[model samples]
Every structure is written in structure tokens, then in C-alpha cells.
Target: MRNMILAVIGLLLLGCSGGQSSNSTMTVSGVAATGAAVSGTIFLKDSAGHELSMATTDGTFSFDVSALKPPFMLKASWGGKTMYSFAAAAGTANITPLTQMIVAAAASSTDLDAAYQAPSPTTFSTIAANLPAATANLRNSLKPLLASYGADMDPISGKFSANGSGMDGLLDHVAVTSVSGTVSITDRSSGATLFSATASPALANSVSAMNWANDSAAVAQDPDLKVSEAGDGLAVWWSYTGTGYGASVIQARWLNSEQSATQISTATGFAMMPKVAIDGNGNAVVVWMQSDNQLNNVWVNRYVAGSGWGSPKKLTSAVSSATGPSGVPSIAIDAAGNAVIMWNQSDAAVSSHFDVYTSQYSVANNAWSTPAMLSTGTNSAYGYKVVANNSGTAAVIYNQFQRTDGRGGNGDASDIWVATGTTAGGFATRTKVSSSANPIYGQGSLAIDPAGDILAAWIQNNNSGYFDVWASRQPAGGSWEAPKTVANSVTGECYSPEVALDAHGNAFATWEQQLDTEGRQYVAASHYSAASGVWDAPAEISENIGNTYDQHIAVDPSGNATLVWYQIESAAVTVRSAQYLQSSGWGISQLIATMGAAYDGYTVFPVPRVAVNSSGKSIIIWGTGSM
Candidate 1:
């Protein structure tokens, strides 16, 4: 009887085990090509069109893709524009072929989306008609996977087509204007055969190395910021002491052989206080305070994705006399590559009191309108920051006080004010954004979600000998909501609040807070759900480190967020990070290995930044004044 029971148990175990999948994850590596890496986002789409992604930096990225199927699609994007697309299949020993993507400047998203024409072939043989050259070895290696998608590559034509289903369904939705380069897949586990899939070689390869730049500083540079669209990121800052105290912009990109930072700014001036914005098509606008011959003026420059930088032009058409100061410039760009620049000027109305002014960049004419005063005040305004949606709607915020000591209204009894603007009328009337009748302290950040909802976070005096962070939101075509406390429930002072929102209208806010219990400062983070209309309880992102601060957060369209900051545990400050997924909440916080080191006593903690894409890939950056 005992033997019978044992045999029955064994049979049950075998039955349960047989139902499990034996497949392991396959790792795929590829280069984004220098130009694509700067202007495109990288994506791995599964059979079901689910995307797994990584930031394509240093020209290479590897993914442990779920091996549920055999074929997958690799895609690159620049905002709404699709830069390039490739196909991949599984290989042995967890290895897949290295893909090389040669990309170039794509057309407007509207034109690119309309480029798809169909009679979509379902089999490789059917679409293979246009192949410049294809190989039989490639067909055998890829047929099974292609059959699954109803998609296949013609070895002779070196082109891919679909049967109007599966992965092809998603691909059909995006336009493919052209194709070039060699895309191959192999089975590396053993003596597996290789695949030769060459698309059209006649297609031009417009991708080239990026003109990236960085300011290596020995002293701390204030007001440095970076932003990205698609997969490319642009970082700009004026050195506290670069040559002639000049400003610079760097285009960080991936390449076939490596990654690099190329300088794109060659303006002749004592430039400082730089502000930059890039559109989805990789076009960028950089504005800085240039003191030429001691005359403070706002100058602007443009960077086209394929072409490089353009000569600097003055954003403010109102000429500032030798004594008149035109500084504190802030700029923002829309998806269409239109830009708006705002600044505080002493010469706008010829009063010692600085008034807020703005100018809009018209892409159609490629010219900035004459400066229009947004804030008509006898008092000076400072802390100019601007944010805009791709729809030509934007807002600018600044601290207003009766006096301006040239410190951006910081450490003063200032009230934060905001003004709404449109491409049609520039900025409209001024409105107060700060909820507190009390003083609004320090600089704040603003972001617009995909749904057109706007969020602004700033620090305010809590009257408890410490400051607190507060937030407010304005829905699309709606009024500004009452201010809500973001991270002040704890028993510490919070400041330097930064906020971002995902496409779903989910919001993530991070700030530096002093812990009353430990007497140490750390970074605190929390999120809000528009569906629930409530904020999550705040959580400490950095635990008992000697010092942890200067964190920034960026969220993807999928409501996932990547938050980065520095930990001064030792003499060297290490860059650490945490990720938030809608499914799992915050993941294990880990030290990112890509950033360089920062030593205390010898170096200032580099301000850290994080940016994430809809596919969950993120670019995390931190640097010393010394690049």
C-alpha cells in the first residue's frame, strides 16, 4: 500500500512539471548607430507588440527578452517619429544577433505616419519580391518566427513585409519610409546555421556621430538641466567659470563603435544661465544669458537633428542698452519644434524694476516675435521657468517680490505667479500658482502630462522653522485646482521639490527632506493617481546615508518612473536610483554603474537626473563640474 501511494505521488508531480515552459530568456545586443542614438528611442516589441526597452547609450544595449516566442521587433523612435525598425529571432545559449541600425532625420510625424501603403504580404516569399538580395540560409532560420507574425524578410530583396497580422499588425500602424543596413540573426548555442538578411543597400545611411557637449567644471554650476524626447537627450549648462565664463550644449548619442558628447555651441560671448528644449524630431533650442561687452542679453541657438547647430540669434528683439540687463531667461519647446522664451528684463519698460517678458519662435518663419511683457509690475520678478505641451499651450512661473537682489527672488518674501500662453496670443494674463499666503521659497519644476494636465511643485514656508513642498494641477481646458501638500506630513523640512507626470496623468514628486530623528538629509518621493485623486503616502528613497539629495524624477507614458540621486556614504558620492512600476511599486534601489564618481571636500555632489521612455528604458545621468 505504501509503494502504491509513492507511485501515485510521483505521477502527480510529473503531470504538474510537464505543464511548465522550458524556454529561457534570450539576450539580444545591438547598436543604435551614432545618429539614431542621439535622436531615436530604442524598443524591443514582442509577438503581442509588448515593448521591452533600454537606453541605447555607448552604441550598445542588451536585453534578456522573454523567450515566449521566436521573433521580435527592434524599433527606434524620435518622439512621435519612428526612426528605424529591425527584426530579431531567438538564438542558442541566450545569444541573439547584434543588430546595426542606420537611421537619419525622419519627416514630420504626420507625414511619417502616412507613409505606410499596403497589399501587405503575409509570407516571407510574398514580400520578398522587392529584396535587393536575400539568402536561403536567412529564410530557413527566420521562417518559423516570421510565420508566427505572418511577416518575413525576402533574402534576395533584403526587405521585410507582413501578411497583415501579429507583429505586423503593430508595424503596419507605423510608417517605414525607407530601410538600409544589414540585419542578421543567428543561433549561437552550437553549430546552428547563420542568417543573411540585407535590406536595401541603395537606401542612404544618413546617421552620423552626434555633436555632443558637456561642461567639465571644477566649481559648482547652478541651474543646470537636461531633457529628452524619443531616446535622445540634450544637456546644457554654463560654467561658473568655463572659458570667458561661457555656456555650452552637448548632444549625447550612441554610435556603432562608441558613445560620445559633441559640442554644438560656438557662440562668441560670456554666456551663462543656459536653458534648452528639444522637440520630438530632434530639433533643439538653447537660450542663454550672454554678456557681450558687459551687456546682458538673451541669445538663442538651434540644433537640427541631421544638420548641426545654427548661429546664435537674440530671442529678445528688444535691444538692451549697455546698462540694461536682459537675464534670467527660460525656454520651452513644443512637439512641432516651436519654442517660447521668457526672461526678466530691466530695459523692457525702462524702469529699474525688472518685468517679465516673452517671445515665441515660429517654425514656419524661423523667427522669434518681438518680446512681449507678460508681467507689468514695478516690482522685480525672478526664477523664470517655462513648460509647454506639443499643442502650443504653455505656462511660465516666477517668484514676484517688491525687490530683486539678483538671486532669483530666493530668500525673499515672494509669491509665485504663473501665466498661460498660446501660440496664437503668446502668454495671457498673470495668475498666482502658490496656494500659500505665506512666502513661497526656492525654485520649482513644472511638467505637462500627455493628457494636457499641468503640474507645478514648489517649496513654501511651513511656519515650523522648516519649509514644505506643495503641488497644484490644472486640467486640460480646466481651472487650476486647490494646492495640495505633497511631502510635508513628515517631521522634517522639505525643499527642492521636483515633479513629473506620466501620460496617464499619474504624478511623481521627489524632494530633499531633513529627517528629524536622524538629523540627516535624504530624498523623499511619492506619487498621485488622477483616477483615485489622492496622493500616496510619502516614502524615503534614500535611507541612512551620510547625505542623500539632489534627486530628479522622470516618468514614462506607462506610469513607470525612474528616480535618481546621489549618496554621500563615503568621500565619493555614488549615484543611486530606484524605479517605480505601476505593477510592482518601487523596485530594489541600486547604484547605477554608468556615472562617474564625486568626492566630497574635493568635489561638489553632481546633480543627478533621470528620464524614462514608454518602453521602460531610462537614461540616468550625473556629473561633476569636472566632466
Candidate 2:
């Protein structure tokens, strides 16, 4: 009987090894040529059009195929475009043929014979043939004027003189005949024409000029404060404008309500990164960085429920000089309305020195405690992101880099570190949550669960020689689980990760990814599951919108997540928002407002920030040119 049992165990072990050897595993890897991965879906399909798998993250992907098939093709899609496609055999490994996949993913004719063909004027002649005769007559009227200007039409702005004199003299001689035309704007999703009007050339020109001037002014302001929510309700905070200079305290009841803003305080210098948290009695604690006399310092202010705003108190005594504290700062408030602020301070006096500092403000005593150092190491510490639970506990996450490290040259090798504290004050020590061997480079964001578990997300330079969005979760008292790549895309760089945790601990992360073809920036998002210990494949949130950057995501109490970002449209940066529908995926994007026109020969980049409350409403604030 013992001999029989041993024979059975040996056969079972041999069977397991044979099964593993027979399985075919293929790993897909590629890098985005642009800044990040574009939003879209990728699927592995067989010859019969059967879907085998899908990819969400941007960087690299792996698949284990038990069944063998020759010439299996994988397709990657984003927006209305298929960004990549490649063929694989039954036993292939390390598939990195990105060129062919990129070519197939471009906007071109699928027909093999027509692949290289470019459409000529003849291709559009059919549409021209259907044009009204009056339209042709209008074109004929401009021909003589265009010919007089050497084949280029100088209609609105007359040709300038060679001596660089004003063109108003030439403009007087040109006569623009009034031609009535109809304009129509249709809702693409609803198949309804929302607006239609008829106007003459003079009216059109007047409206165009007005719009141009408005957009121009809007862009010139650089950073402008926008109200996210308002009117005596739940969780209200104010956003700063003017290159993140100063902010006011805005009170709001819900997301869509108009905000009643009260100027909290403004220094002669700039202020930025203002954070606000509300206590049970409707009191608010606000903290931000202030700059004056070339020195950037931290400040805090409080607003009582019945009383008015309190006097601004300076938290940091660091002088802003050639070497001073810099980068973005974060703040959180506890139930007692005490404020906890964290910021990165550089000590130029010490070699290889940068540290994360924290301080506490007591509402009862109306005083701030002495600042405490949270990180102790040789590397430069930066990118301090903090979150506070009402239970007087706050968690801070930041990137720590070792100077002169060979890994990514200087400032290349970094990792995410987390520090937890019982009070909304100083941290005892910070522990490294990310793996030490595989360090992350870019800045990361953090979200804390109701139970005090910490979830952090950041962009990491992976072993595949590309950057991808990675996430790490640490239970309340346990060590951090292994880091996992959330979104898999190989077309571009992924950076600026922001995460939001719902009440149930569901995590949603959003970041900017690059497209393979146009090199346009796109927004991608994914969710982390605690039970499965796996990140759901990332999905593109914005499809029609392109050139998106600085995406911020927030989750409502209903477990729905809303994503907001700045997108370039018609040469202006516009703030756009998209909400995640429970069963319908992402809703159609809506444009919030346009920032303004080009500034100093370049369009201003809109770095909008967003926050949402438990009531399924959100407030989005951004800087823009004044009207």
C-alpha cells in the first residue's frame, strides 16, 4: 500500500510539471512615444474574431494561453481609433513589435491596396458638387480680392505694407458683401440639434471678434479661481487663482449650487495649494503656502460656524530665498478642527538635504505646535500628499529619492513612503510602502480608507524600460501588499497619478497617458479590488476630448467616480468633466469653461483640480483668464 501511494504522488507531481510546461505564456510590452497612454480598450482576438483578453494599464501586459494557436492577433483601441495590433504564435514570448502595431492603429484605409493612398481634391469633389449655387457665387466674389493679394485671401485682416505700417489703409478699400448663413450645433449623443441660427457676415465677424478677445483675456490670467461648490452645505473649500497665488473661503451646500466666497486673506506675495476640511459643527480649517519677500512660508486660517474668519497665522518661519521650501503643500483637518499641514522643505545649509515637515494647529489653544521632521534619510524628499480621517488620524505619502544614485541618474530613483499619526499633528516615523528594489520616480497621490488603510498610486519606471501606473495598498496594521501595475499601455509615458477611495474602500485612480500616433494626451482610469488583490484593467475616460493633462479624480458616496482635467480646444485650455456611471461606463464629457487665450506666444496650460463629496456631487476649480 505504501509503494502504491508513493507511485500515485510521483505521478501527480509529474502531471503538474507537465501541465505548466505545456501552457503557452506571452508577455506584451511597449512604450508610449508621447507623455502618457491614451484612453482606450485593448483586446486579444483569435482568427475567428473571438476575444481572448484585454489590457487596461499602459506599459506592458502578459497573457498565459493554455490552448495553442498560430498567428494570433491582439488589437488595442482608444477613442474611435485602433492604436495597435500585432500577431503572435502559440509559444511566443516578449512580443515587442510595436511599429507594425502602431501603423495598423493609425487613421488610414484598412484596404491593403489603399493603405498608402492619400486622398486628393477629387476625393472631396462629390461633397462640393452638392453645394448650393449661391455658395459658389460667394466664392467667385472673393477670387479677384484673393488674386490681388497674390493668391492668399486677406479678408478680415488686410495685407500689411512692406514698411510695416498699419493695414487699416488697405482695409478701407476692401468691401465685404453681406451673405446670410445658417449655423447649427447638434448633440452628438442625443442626435438633437441644440442650436441653429442664421446670420450675416457682419454679425459673424462681430461675434467672432468678441469671442477671440474673451478667450484671449481668459488665457492671460494664467490661474483663476473657479467655484466648485457653494452655499452653506457639506464640505466646502476655496481654490486659488493667478498662478496659484491666493484663495478665498467659499461656502457651498451642494455641487451645483452657487458659492458664497469670502476672501480669507491674501499676502503681498503669492499663495498656493489651499486645503480645507470641515468639522461637525460646520467650522473649517484651511492651510496653504504663502510667499512674501522672496520667502515661501506656510499659513493657516480658521472659520467658525457662527463667527467670521480668523486671523491668518504663519506656520513656517523658513525664508524663501535662493534656497528655500518649495513644491506643493497639503493640509488636512480633524473632527476638532485642528489642522495638520505637510510640505517639502529644502535645507540648503546641509549636503543632499531635503525633508518632509509637519505641524499641528490647535483650535482650542489657537496656536501651532513646533514643526517636526517626518523623514530622516540621505535622499531628497518631495511630493508630499496627505489625507486625514475624521478620527484624528492623518496619513502622509511622499516620494524619497537618493541623490547621485546610478539608477535613473540623479533624481531618477525614488519610492513612495507612508507615515501615519494618531493626532492630526506630527508623525513619529515614516515607513517605505513601495518595494525598495524597484523604486518609483514620479510624484504620487494617496487615499485613506475609512478603516485607516492607506492606498497610494504613482507612475513607476518599470523593468520593461517604460513608465506605468502602479498602486500599493497597506492595511491598517499590516505591511503593504506587493505593488501591482494597474494600467498596461506601451505607447507612451504615464504620470501624475491621483487616487480616491470610497467609503467601502473601492479605489479609483486617474492619470494622463500618451497616444501612439498623434502624441496627444489622454485620461485613463482603473479600480483596485481589495478582495481579489488585482487591479481592474484601465479604461479610457475621455475619448472625443484630446490633449488632456493634470487629471484629478474623486469618488462619491455612491461609489461613482468623477474625473476632471484640462483639455486644449480651439487653441484654448478648457476644463472638462466626466462622471463614471454605475452600469453605463463613463458619461459624455461636458466642458466646464475655457481658461483664456494664448499667452506670450504659447497657450496657457490649465492645471485644474477637482474634489467630490459623499452626496454624489463634485466641485471642479481651475485657473483661467478673467472675463
Candidate 3:
């Protein structure tokens, strides 16, 4: 089927000023379907998305429109219907009476409200309030396009009507960079096109093209288990290489349980390892590394509650001697939707010329600060893991290897360091997390409680021809607790530690270990009691049948948890899972699926990610294969 190209029909035009001025002026005009006089408010907005002027519409609308600059946007809306269009200012800009009809006919107020509440991955809501009932932290950051709305009557038809232009806002935000872009509306189900247009680069990345679905909720998916405090939804992000494009593009998809997934990646490039941070409201911030024709740079995209995803903004400039290609990005969002993204890039100042760099997202300014170096005087740093709590403070922990100061036990040893940040003050100086100079292996994981307390897990060299999982805890605004062994000394070659903090302040830690007794690898877990400040004995969770690898766990608000992993023994690989009840310990491990032919004789590695909400709803995703 051919894609829908909505033809925006126009009527008449009007303006307050008869002549031109310092800036270009655009006048928008509209008329009732019946050719009768109607009333509604018209708003004039600046290029920065700030409201400039508003007036009553009497079958026509007009404004100075000078602040909006060239390629201006005009909107005419009333009740549940709004029609908006973009054009250059040679003369008057014409608009349709009902460019977008939310309801067939405004028979009742409830019908109008329902149209306003419907969700569309391509469309955005006009209201700017924080929808606590839907999700406390969910919000549409687009400033209101209208100052207010009122009730009016048709002069000729004598019918009551909603007297306000329906246009909520436009992508008139201040441009982060002057790159031209396109705006497109797509079908979440099939990636089919609905409507699209070329626009200033700022507008293209700031809004998603959308059309409403015929349902109570908007069409979307929650594959990442990022349940919306505003409602039930999930979100996930990834990057895939393209054949013809010659560059990889970052991808994001979100949906409710009943809806199909919506893809939010608008551009293609050499993007990889996309990371996400969803707030309590299901609003998300996605960050990834993309290589232009030249070098890799860090870019970020944001989803406004009710509105959908916005444009991607570059966080780093071209790679200079001062900085190299940005990669291995990680991000965390606070309850308020504020976010922080960090990555390791080449810096001339660092000893190895590669150091940890970070940028903080400001909701007030709707922009990211220039990338700043967080690791200084360190020989080399990488493997950054970051997490933010409700209080807006974030903890970043990464490995600093081959130090010039010789603090590490071995000259080549590496240690984990922690950095903290707030909206007011960016990341503080690095704090050594691991005590010894021994090498820390893999990426470190950090989790923060509501009170700002933190728990971290990582693999460290035991120095006795073996490796073990170590743990650390920090009280709110206090010094770190001495690192302690979280694993049983039952074997060697233990690593890949992951940590999760439940609502009750309990910290759950899981890791992979080689079993000498069984001559195989197994998964082990332990629980930490916040009240007693003690850790329970480690328990083996995987069967001895095969090599247990890539374990993932997510706990609901009730403290119930689900763990997923893949086991490879011989020719066939099996995906297995188990449940952990608060009162009863782990349930029987169950078979999720079997995969052998899927590999097609090629070597395969799987790392599953899991997320669960309070009601036991879980979303599990993995690469190569999924359960």
C-alpha cells in the first residue's frame, strides 16, 4: 500500500501588521467547514519555542511572527482538532480548519478529552502538565503553544465550541547545531510510512511523526520493561549495521503490552552499543556512539512523556588531539528525567591519551553540556557503569588501569574508581573504589537506592591463581565500606558480577563461577540485608548439566525476582530460567527454549538483559537469540 501523504489544504490569511519589519512575518488563516464564523485562540511562538503572543480567532488568525524567523510554523486548532503547517515567509501562511481531526465530531466533552488522551508513537500531546495518574515522572517538555483555552459560541450556527487552537507546540526549540533534517511519521507495527517532510535539523530530531490508533491507549511496546509510572509500557534500544547505507544506525522501540513496537531511530550512520535510561514515567534517554565519515561521536535522543521521541543531538565535536572517537556509552536518568551520559575517548592530557568523559543533560535548557574529562592523572580508564537515584545524584564507576602513581599492586593492574555528580555540580573527582592494586576485570556494575546509598559489584583478582567476585557499599553521602568478598571460596575463575537493589534496600548480587567439583561453570547469587548490614551465604542457581553463562536478573517491587541464562553443553544450547520468591528462595529451574540449529555451526555468545515491574511483569531480551 502506498504511504499517506496528508495534503494540507489552506483557506485565508490575516495579520496584525500590514507591512514587513526587522524580521519576517508569517500570517496564518483558516475558516469553519460550513463557511461560518468560529472562535478560537491563536498563539505566536518564537523559534526557541517560547510563547510570544496569543489572540482570539474569528474565522481568521494573525501575528507578528517575526521572532520565529524564516521557515516559520503555523497552527490552527480548536477542541480536539489541530492543523499545523510549516512554510517560508514570502507572504501570508494559510492553514486548514481541521488539519488533524482527533474526533469525527465534537458531540460531547468526553469524546474530546478521549481524543486528547489517545497515544500515537508518531503524534504528541498538546498538554504540558506532568501526568502523575499516567506516570508521576512522565512529562511533555514542549512548552505550551497556547496561553489558555476558553469556551465560545458560533456566531452564525449558535453552537457551543472549544475556543482554542489545538496546536500544542512546534519543534521551534533552539537548534543545538545547524544540521538540516527530516520529520517522519511511521507505523509502529510494520515500519510503514504514514507522513513525512523535510525540516530544519532541530525540528526533525525533536518530534516523532504519529497518527492515533483506534484504542483506549496509544500503540506502543514495552520490550525493555520500563513500566511507565504514567502507565504500563516498556522500552528498549539497540544498533544494527545497514547494508546499502554502509553505516550502523541506532534503534529504539517502545510499546504497551497490546501494541506493536515503534522504532525511533531517524538517521543512519555507524552507530553501535546504544544505551538507555528510562525514568519512572517511562520517558527515556538514549545515547550511542556514531561515526560520521570521519570519527566517532556521542549522540543522545530524548522521549518527552506523551509526546514521543525527539531529535538526536551530538555531544562531542570532531576528534582532535584533545579528544578521540567516543564509544562505549552509558547513561542514567533520575526520577525527574534528568540524565547523565559517559564514555571513554582519546584525550591528549591523559597518559594513555584515552580517559573517561561525561556530559550532563539539563531539562531546564533542553541541552547537554560540553563533554568534560572525569578521570585525570590516570594512566588509562574505560569500562564506565553509571546509575542515578530518585534524588538526582548519579554514581559512575569505571576501571582505571596501568596507573602512573603505582597504587595498583602490579604495575599493569587496574582498579575501579567511583565518581558522583548532580545537576548543579557535574561529576566530582574520581574516588578509588577497589582497595587493592590488583586488576579488576570486565565492566563494573553500580546500583543506587532511593536514599542515595550505593552498592557495587565487580570481578577482582584474588592473587592466589584465582579470581573472585567482590562487593562494596556506600551509605548516603558517606565514605565507602571496605570491599568484601561476596562469593564462596569454593572455586577459581569466578567473574562477571551483577548487582541489583530492591525497594527494601536489599542488595542482590549474582556472578559466574567455575565449579571444581562438577568440572563446569555455574551461576551463584547472594542477598544482602540492609537492616542487619550482612550478606547471606552464596547459593548456586544453575544446574551442573552445562556451562552456565550470561546470567541476568530483575526483581519486582515485591522483592520477587526472575533470573535468565543460557546453558551450553554439547551440540545444543538451552535457555533456562528460575524464579526467586521473597519468603521461599528459588523455585525449580525451567527450560525456556533450545537453540542449536539457530547457530548454524557458527560460534554464538548470548547476553540476556531483564527488567521487571512490581506486578511481576517482566521483559527479557538477548542478542543472537531471545527467550
Candidate 4:
């Protein structure tokens, strides 16, 4: 009887132990997102580099952690980037870019892979202890965004869905990137920075919002944004589809002390490609191509210092109801508010041929002069770019097709030509600047210095059938230098060169270079030092991931420059930029805008434009199809 009773007690103890084991099976669950649902595998890992649980998720995930340990790391991989989250107790942990930022801040390091591969009990404890503070710091940094999106719940441990609401909405409008132990938060729509500093506990307390320029809205493509040399004024213009007119119209915004977007073009057909320039005295000149049902004409508008945008003025005439049009307008303004405008207009007498034309804006009279024919070429000429110096000297460059040059028309082979003039439209004799054997020199960009020196950059096909970047320098009151190749890749083509010159005559040029026959292009830049009188070897300014194009560069009086471009990689399109300092060389490229996944196929890759002031203050603007 005693042996039987002892056996019964042992059985009762075993039953109780099994019941406790069944009750202690804990499961961790949450959502994984990066604007769009992370439709990938989510892994739950421990501090010991052990994968505790793995599950495929459409964003929401659950991990059975009954047999796992504490201090877990949740990772979601997508878009070739890994996002992470930390869970001390494993209740709910959402894997996201922001959560990874918080984890990085708590650990005082951005090398998350290193930490994840080699974490100790002490390291895990330290991260757990600092998680709250890090969370608060990230929240503070994103206060405005959180408030705007109404995301009051905790990002890591919150019960949120990846359905474009709450935390998902916040994620849609911001881009969080970690580099060199620092975290940067930028507005996704505008690329306006919100916070950039070391991922530490003091981040939110020491940093204020850098997104004051956010308008919470977007414009159409081909927007031009410029800043004054004094850094006190800003002007932006773009062409957008009008509601009542059922056609595209040009609109502008001037910010000195107050501003709002005002439509400058009253076109019934379409007004497009609005380019703007702001002078030192807070004055601005905007020019665009407006259609009058039969022919497209160039129009101009001026914004006075104290007043708003003046009425739109037509600079070119729609001579006849013929199909010939005047378009591709470019503008520049001098320090004294003098302006120069350039465009290509069809020669009424010559069919199917276009000629370059120029018009000047007088600050004294606040009126644009009559369009003057600058290119006397009987051959077709187009792709005009213009720039103005502080002394009111303007420079223009274009490409003119030759009738037959034995070499090869290759479907309209052209030569690059340049000319200089005054703000009063009196241009000097046109000079052919490019002497390349390949007659197809195009994509010309022009820049002028305070002393009236001009730099022209273009691309011409080499004998190998690959396009290469070529640039020439015309010294103040001197002849044009022989065009030199600045960038030549062995297997790919380079095109769309943009050049900018500072007051000291230093020139910076950037262009898009093809990576493969698959149509992948990367941004490459070369610096031309006036002191050295040589173009530096070209450097790749962007990653070789996408097709980059529409690159535009601007320089201030102090030799500081800002270059902007847009890249399309897969279904994602991004606006990116790089800064050039005379003292430090070119800085690393940065993200200016990241179009959200909601409009993946419908995304509009706007031609990103940037302007910088002498103080290095810059404002970049681009258009979008949707928010």
C-alpha cells in the first residue's frame, strides 16, 4: 500500500508539470511594413545568433516563441534592405525601418548586422535598458509626422495594421536611413530633411525639424525652384493640368516674407516647361512654352520684390495658324534683375526647320524685349540652354543639324554651337564650340561666371558608337578652348550633361552614364578647377542601381553647388542629390524624395531641379503625379 501511494504522488507531480508547460507557450506577433506591406519572410532571432522562429508574412506575422529565449530581434527583408525590431518581452514587435532606427539608436551603433551576429548577454541587457529612451528620442524626432498621421501608438509594440493608416501612413511620408552610425529622417514627398544626427539618446532633444519647407502637397513635372544669392528669397514654378481650362497651365510661388502658388500662364491649349530664376534683390523671372491651339509660343512673367507675380507676357509670336511651334524655353537672371530667355522657334520661311531665338527682360521697364533670332543657321537648330552673369552678360548654347557631311547624318547629325550676349538681346556672332568627328553633339548645358567666362558641356558619339561627355571653356573676352572628353566609359554611353560655374570660374559637370545595354544609367560628375585649368577624372556620384536622368546642377558665388536627378529602379523612383564644396569636394549623394508604393506604376519621375545660395542654403523641387 505504501509503494502504491508513492507512485500516485509521482504521477500527480508529473501531470502538474505538463500542465504548466502547456500554459507557458508564448507567441509573438506584429506587422511588418515599409510604406507597403513587407510581403516577405519574417525571422525571429535571439541574441545568440540563433533563429528562433520563421514565418512568411504579407505584413502581419506571428512567431511561436514557446521554446525560444528572451531579448529577441525581429527582422523583415525587402527591397534588398533589412528592417529590424527589438522585443524585450516578446509581446508585440513590428518590424519596420523606424523600428530599426530605434534599435540602432538604443545600441549606439548602426552596424546592426554586426551586433546581431555577435551579441552577448550584457549587450542585450544594455539594449533592453536603453530601448525606452531610444523610442522616445525617435518619437520626438518624428513628432510632426506622428501628429500629422495621428499615430499615437508605439511603433514597435503597437497593435497597428499595414493598411495605409496610422503608423503605415507615417511610414509612407518619411524615409529613414542609417549611415556611418548616424540616422537621417527626411520627408518622402519633398526630400526635405527632418532630422539628421548620430543615433543617440540626445537626438530628439538637440535637433529641431528641418522640414519647414514642407507644403504637404506636390506639383506636376518640370518644376524649377531657385534661391537668391542672399539666401533670403525663393521662387518655384511648374506646369500642371488645369481644372477649368482642361489644359496645362504654369504656376509659380515666391517666398520672401509670404507666398502662395499663383498661376502665371493663361493658356487655353497647354503651357509647359516653366523655368524660373531669382536675382539677388528677390526679383524673379519665369518663362514657359504656351500653345495657342495652332502654334506654341514662349511666354514670360516677372515677380517684383515687394509685389507678386506680374501678368504673363508673350515673348514669341504665333505668326501663323501653321503647325510650326516655338518651345524648349530656358531662362536666367542677373544680380541686377536683368534676365535672358532662349528657345527654339520654327523658321516660318523654312519648313520643318527650327532656329534659336532670345529675348531679354529689363528691370527698369519690367518688360520683355522682342524675340531676336540668334542662330542664323539655315539648318535646323534646337536644344538651347542659357545662363547670365552678374554683369548682365548672357551665354547660350545649342545644336544645329548639318545638311550632309559625308561622315553620317545618323538621322540628323548636329554640331554644338555657343554665343554670348547682353541682357538687351544683342548677341555676338555664333561660334561652333564642338569639333568632334561625330556630328551628333547634343544635350548641351551652359554656365557663366561673374567675369563672363562660359563653360559648355555636351555629349557626342565616339567612333565606338558610344556617347561620351565633352566640355569646352570660353574664357572671358577670349576664344573657345578645344572641346575635351571628360568622361568615357568602355562599354556604355553617357548623355544629358549639365554644367554649372561659380563666380570664380570653377565648373562642375554631371551626367547620366549607361551601365549596361539593359538601359541602366548612373550619375557621374567631374570637376573643372579654374586654378588647374583641367577637368578632374570623372567620379561615379550615384549607385549603379537604376536609370538616372534629367540631372541639373547649380552653383553659387562661393563655388558651392547642388546637383539633382531622378532615378527609376524597378517600380521605385527616387529623387537624389549631391553637394559640391570648393573646400571638401563632392559629398555623398543623399535621398531627396522617395515615391511611396501606392503610386508605383503611376509615379511621375519629375526632372529634379536645385538652386543654391552663397551661404550653401538650397531648395530642391520636383513634380509628382500623386501624393
Candidate 1, which segments miss by more than 4 Å at Cα? 1-230, 237-262, 317-323, 346-353, 402-412, 593-598, 601-603, 613-616
In candidate 1, what are the lDDT values of residues 187-222, reduced to their tens digit?
A: 222211122222333111111101111233223243
lDDT of 3 by residue, 432-534 (tens): 8787756667458888867788888788777675777888898887888999878746466886788888777788888788877668888888988889988
TM-score of each: 0.62, 0.58, 0.60, 0.66
Clashes of each: 23, 36, 21, 1
lDDT of 2 by residue, 148-174 (tens): 334232221112222211222212232
Q: Give me the displacement of residue 401 in model 4, in angstroms.
A: 1.6
Select the stronger candidate by TM-score from 1 and 3. 1
Q: After superposition, how far is residue 335 of candidate 4 from its true place, in Å?
A: 1.1
Q: Is 2 or 4 the stronger prediction by TM-score?
A: 4
Q: List the residue pairs that clash in candidate 4.
A: 191-592
Model 2's TM-score against the true structure: 0.58
lDDT of 3: 0.55
Q: How would you order the candidates by lDDT, starting with the best?
A: 4, 1, 3, 2
Error of 3 at 180 (Å): 59
TM-score (C-alpha) between model 1 and the true structure: 0.62
